[model samples]
Target: MKIAINGFGRIGRTILRQILTTARGSGIQVLCINDIAEPEMCAYLFQYDSTFGPFPGQVALETGALVVDGRRIPLHQQANVTALDLSGADVLLDCTGIARSTDLAERGLSAGATKVLISGPSPAAEATVVYGVNTKDIKGARIVSNASCTTNAVAALVQLVDQVAGIDSGHMTTIHCYTNSQPMVDAPRGDFARSRGGAQSMVPTTTSAMHLIDVVLPHLRGRISGAAVRVPTASVSAVDLVARLNTPLAEADLMVALRAAADRSPVLGWTDQPLVSSDLRARPESLVIAAPETRIVDSRQLRIFGWYDNEWGFSARMLDVAAKMAEAD
Candidate 1:
């Protein structure tokens, strides 16, 4: 059950740490990292340091790779996925978010991997998984995509509502954090032509999270819409939701239903008191189902709020999904 990692940035490093520390036994002997950055920088980032917080075990920096609990993982310096030697791994985790699923998945399959899972969304995935919602559908998927953080949270909300109160329709606004792709200061960048020079400012853009949520929660498929705004913050974000309910539910009943749903969904949690984005980020869970300060503008509509750690929490869930894929194979 050996595994290979394609990127070593924030999500990539977090995946590496999760795989090595978990007792689930991924048997990830060789970590073939394909990144443009220098190999030593990747090693430095993956190497565990107690200064940040507590680690499950010690991580040592060996000659040219990282060692954890006596397993020495060889880090290949190759930048091209096709050129790398992946003959030993059973699965490959594509954390690069490059959206080259067809090429990378074919490369891994050619290299003798049983399956490949992408941490971010990919158009070629057999199905997009949202853990508690559609993980059962991934029993034999060859290639899978764990939806984005915003998608995960929104999907959880939709599933809970659809199961309990019943949803007529909904919309989401994801206030996300800055990513590594964005410049620290205002400068010309890629994508939106008008967004070329405003990395430091709030950039209103569209998010496919709502569109992709249907891949997991088919009941709400095409029934919801979403938009995104990139804030200056680095890690935490919140999802503001507005929904048309099938039946009017009292605030107390809705809160109880949400908490019950959270208890069922390990990644989804509930918080009663008022909380900021930073407070929910510290919960150490993939998704938190905070009972929103709900209000009914009319007889059949309700609104909710949810928060998540765009990188750490959601990325951790990606690692969990990848691990499950390895175990099933």
Candidate 2:
């Protein structure tokens, strides 16, 4: 199965790297990459050993191909979807984060792909998927979304809470990693006022992930409220989730349910020990189901913490889900 990626930034390159390491790599023939950045630099980024962490072996760049674990795989570069080489590709993962579903979806089809998946939620699209909660909804999904990392973490948490104790309501405060949007030196952006003043500040930002949470957890509509805090870190983020349960259980039982639920879903995990946001930074997987301290904010209110490697984790699951959907067809 051949695959094409729309952007070569964080998520796009991560997707490329993961596919190369998969058991299906040998059968996967071509990897088509499209980005506005210098294609050579982007290609080189995948060639060298990842600074985030080492994979099993080094990946070498060979002329117009990438040697993953010593196996040669052909590469093609394009600046945009219009020029992308997707002739034999069965799937396309759009990590551009442009959120333009119609354009990317059409481009994927035009490039000869049967399915198109995106790394982030597309508000205009039909399906927004959280790996554990709604992966089964991917049937006939020519266009699908991984939902943002915040969405994934929150969705999994809510699913677990609702299943074990039943949710009366839920809310989240995502202490997110800084993104390309903010200035490193407090320079002015087009929207000068909003991001202008806070180069080093803990910027309070509106999260689309909150809206996406409702999309993923349909039962939580009108019951959940959400917000975000964009921190100075480059990667990794945590969700501070609080939920009012229909029935209250002891803290130990709650942790037990979370661990059990995480075990049932590969995307979810529960670390028995203490973990911080920095601890999860650059982890290859998206959903790390670690529940920190549980607090009762009110009579029925409970607060929990979860961590994720926002870009890597979310992109990884997006690729996994898209591949599974393709194979199912």
**lDDT (CA) for every model shown?**
0.72, 0.72
Tens-place lDDT per residue, model 1, 59-116, is 6656666666677777665656767777777678777788455876566666666778
Count of steric clashes across candidates, in order: 1, 3
- Scored by lDDT, model 1 comes in at 0.72
Error of 2 at 227 (Å): 0.8
Error of 1 at 143 (Å): 1.2
Q: Over the stretch 228-287, how does candidate 2's per-residue lDDT look in tens digits?
A: 888877778888888888987777776677677778876776676788777876565556
Error of 2 at 119 (Å): 1.5
Clashing residue pairs in candidate 1 are 269-289
What shift in Å separates residue 327 of candidate 1 from its native position after superposition?
Answer: 4.1
